[model samples]
Target: MAIELKEYIVAFIDLLGFSAMVQHDCERPKKEHRYIKVLYTIHLKTKELKKTIIGLEITQFSDSVVLAIPYSQENYKKVVDVISNYQYDLLNDGILCRGGASYGKHFSTEDFLFSNGMIDAYKIESTIALTPRVIISKELIDLVYPASELSKNEHLILESDGLYFINYMKNGNADDSWKAICKAIPDELSENPSIRSKHIWLIDYYNHQFPESKRKDNHRFVSPDA
Candidate 1:
């Protein structure tokens, strides 16, 4: 049989501190269980969401999730929206994820995920996505929007460091959820040094995006070191 290859928008995501969460749950007494249940719930919800979104194909194992969607202008937008919503939902549930999105030819099956797209996505997620955000590859961005049209889009933000990530809270639709995620960041930062460091960019982004008046009365941006 000839192997099939087609263009796709691929996303590679990692559930931050998953091993540590499991370890913490194991070390704690049975009555104090929390992380495992939360992770399981998030996993189930993600699966359900992926099923509802047509054209999306997902494969998950342990703490990693790989999603692929057929490539087209409409499909591209749909994939971006799906990823943004998924990320927000996870954040609302007190779980942070970091990932990367790329576009290229790829192929997958029930037991296999193979593609240059997947490799590129993994590279971006592991390196460019140092914080709790999904970085988009330049190739994908250029394919979706040319240089002249880039600034007109509010859905994506280009960072000073030349990386582009979805602006999930853009346009005020997710104001309440964004605020909640911001407030929860400090507690998440206490998880462990690695997790805390990974979330520092999230904290900084929240501080820059939200004004003091919008912050919870008792909520303050806590340094990861604190």
Candidate 2:
């Protein structure tokens, strides 16, 4: 069978600390099955978003989710909108994720997906997206015209590393998300120091983006040397 290959904007996302969620499912009581509920909510939201956004194709397995759309300025905005909203909602639910969005040739079906775009997206998520954020590729950025458009500025934040990522809290409703982080960070901070550093990176990003918020100071973590 001949496949219809076309350019696509693909976002590959992975849930952070997913194994811990799976572990808690079995070890915790039924009423306390937090991860299950969160996963179910994400499932429903993703379903609705797919319906709302025409041409958006999705594939999920275990901890990872892939969202793709036909490459076009309109479709690119649509896909970015989906990721921004999804990331914001996840942070509200105390679930952080990392992802990479890029554009390349792709083809996908219910049971199979073959795409260089997927490879690029996943590589970004795994290697480039070193923290809980969705990093957009330089290639993808070039495709979006008006370079550094103000409207786009609300969603994209340029990092010191020269990568751009979705600014999930730029709309200024970070209070709930701030509260969620307060609850989630303590546990991760107590575990692996590396994981703790990742959480701190997020906190630093959050504080840098929303400096006016009073909660910023409380969110800070003192360095071990300090």
Candidate 3:
């Protein structure tokens, strides 16, 4: 069959600490079976997301998941919503992830995946998205929502470094997920020091985006125990 290349918005997501999650379980006593729960959780959550979200094609392997959608305003919006929700859901389950979304030419199918779109998304996710946030490529932003319109968009925030990341806390009710992510930072900092700086950046961004007033119950930070 001939390869069919087309424009697509691709998202590449990596589960943070996945290797550690596996290693920790591997080193445990064989009879303890602690890793079963982690494996089950990942399976359940991915299955749930796939069933819940539509209009996108997904390919998942080990700690990475790739989602692709045909380029369109509606499709792009769905991509953003699915990715944002997936990130938040994972955080609530004590698993953090980072990813990148880009738009370009690509070929993807149930059994095969290849393209510059995938390459761009992977590069951004591995290099740029060091935190538990899905960084949107400027190429995607320009293709989906031009700069003039994005300036007034509340769901997306342009950081000081000029990269645009989704403000998952937007629309008001996502506060709980936002708080959960903040609460997870300290624990992740110790577990994964390589991304410590990115975690700090995420915390700073969260504080700036949701100030004391915007925060519920007059709390600046949620208790890790809570």
C-alpha TM-scores of all predictions: 0.85, 0.89, 0.82
Top candidate, metric lDDT: 2
> Which number leads on TM-score?
2
Per-residue lDDT of 8-111 in model 3, one digit per residue for the tens?
A: 88889998878877888788887765555866777777766666556577888988988887788888887788777777677666677888999888886678
Off by over 4 Å in 2: 146-152, 214-226
Which candidate order results from sorting by TM-score in descending order?
2, 1, 3
Which 10-residue window in model 2 sums to the lowest lDDT?
212-221
Clashes of 3: 0
What is residue 13's positional error in candidate 2, in angstroms? 0.5
lDDT of 1 by residue, 1-226 (tens): 5689999999999988789789999999999887888888888887876775686888889999999987998888888888888887877777888899998889888897778899999999988888888999999998888788888877788888999898765534436756657644775346566666655666666655565534334334667888
lDDT of 1: 0.80
lDDT of 2 at 40: 79
Q: Write the per-residue lDDT of candidate 2 for residues 54-136, one digit (tens) a residue.
A: 88998888889999889998888777878888887787777889999999999998899989999999999998897898999
